[model samples]
Target: MIKSVAHAMIYVLNQDEALDFYKNKLGFEVGDDMKVEGGFRWLTVYPKTQSQLQLVLAEPKEGPLFTKDSAEKIRSLIEEGAFGAGVFETENCQKTYEELVAKGVEFIQPPTEQLYGVEAMGIDNSGNWFSLVQREK
Candidate 1:
């Protein structure tokens, strides 16, 4: 049986831009950024407070995982904002939203009171949307 998740993949168009967005805008820390065989870059980022699960910033190219056609389709879908990254927990949704907005993060929804708590929807530089939530205690 699996104990827990160690990494999650987030497909991106450009690794450098994704790195800047996740690191600077969201304040995530870099876990691993290294070049492997076949010139593939293995980059991962995680929240500052939590480093257990790293988000792999992977660029979809014609490689082992996908064909040229599939890679193109995935890239197109990513640019169309059809994919969601994941929900990010925050202590204060409103405050985090304000900070992110000031840092050039695009938000489709402002912090609103949800059934569980406050929630806001934001889009990363790569057009992946994610929810910022503050759960009720």
Candidate 2:
């Protein structure tokens, strides 16, 4: 059985840009940044507070995971903001939203009261939407 969630993949348009966004803007630490055998880059970043779970920033290129046609399709979808990464928990949704906005992050929805907490919707550099939530106690 799997012990724990180690890494989650997020398809990116460019690894370098994604690195800048996640590391510089989102304040995540890079767990790994090495080139694989077949010109693939294994770049992963984790939140500063939680280093165990890393987000693998993968470029959808024609090599291992994608063929040329499929890679192009995936790229198109990413550009169109068709993917939702997942929910990201924050202690203060409003504060996080303001900080991210100051750093040039785009939020589709402002922080609003939800049944469970304060929630906001935002798009990352790769055109993936993520929910920023502050859970109620």
Candidate 3:
């Protein structure tokens, strides 16, 4: 049987930029920052609350997981705004959105109430969209 999701991988143009965005802008703590085989960087981050689940930030390049052509295609798709990298659950959507905006994060939409919850959409430094959601209490 399939288990719960462990982590999510997001392709980034530059690891340094991604690190700054995730760490400084969004307040995600750095989980891993090291180099593995084939000169590839293995970097990960996790939210302050969900420290168990990490988000992998990988650079699309020639590697065992992806060929050069495929990496290019993925980069193109990301640049075209075709990817929703992940959703981040927060205790308060509006407060978190305001804090992120003060740190220069660009938001696609402000917090809006829906049947499910209140959600705010924002784009990461790599152009991947993420939803900041707060479930109704």
Cα TM-score per model: 0.97, 0.97, 0.93
For residue 53, model 1's alpha carbon misses the true position, in angstroms, by: 0.7
Better of 1 and 3 by TM-score: 1
Model 1 deviation from native, Cα RMSD in Å? 0.7
In the range 1-137, model 3's lDDT, one tens digit per residue, is 97777678988878899999999998889999999788888899998888778999988888877899998998898888787868888889999899999999999999999887999999998899999899988
Alpha-carbon lDDT of model 1: 0.95
- TM-score of candidate 1 on Cα atoms, chains taken together: 0.97
Cα lDDT computed for each candidate against the true fold: 0.95, 0.94, 0.89
- Assess the local accuracy of residue 92 in candidate 1 as a C-alpha lDDT between 0 and 100: 98
- Pick the lDDT winner: 1
The segments of candidate 2 whose C-alpha lies over 4 angstroms from its true place after superposition are: none
TM-score of candidate 2 versus the correct structure, residues matched by position: 0.97
Query: Candidate 1: where is the Cα deviation over 4 Å?
Result: none
Stretches of model 3 off by over 4 angstroms after superposition: 1-4
Q: Estimate, for each residue in 26-103, the C-alpha lDDT of model 1 and write its tens digit.
A: 999999999888778899999999999999999999877789999999999999999888999999999999999999
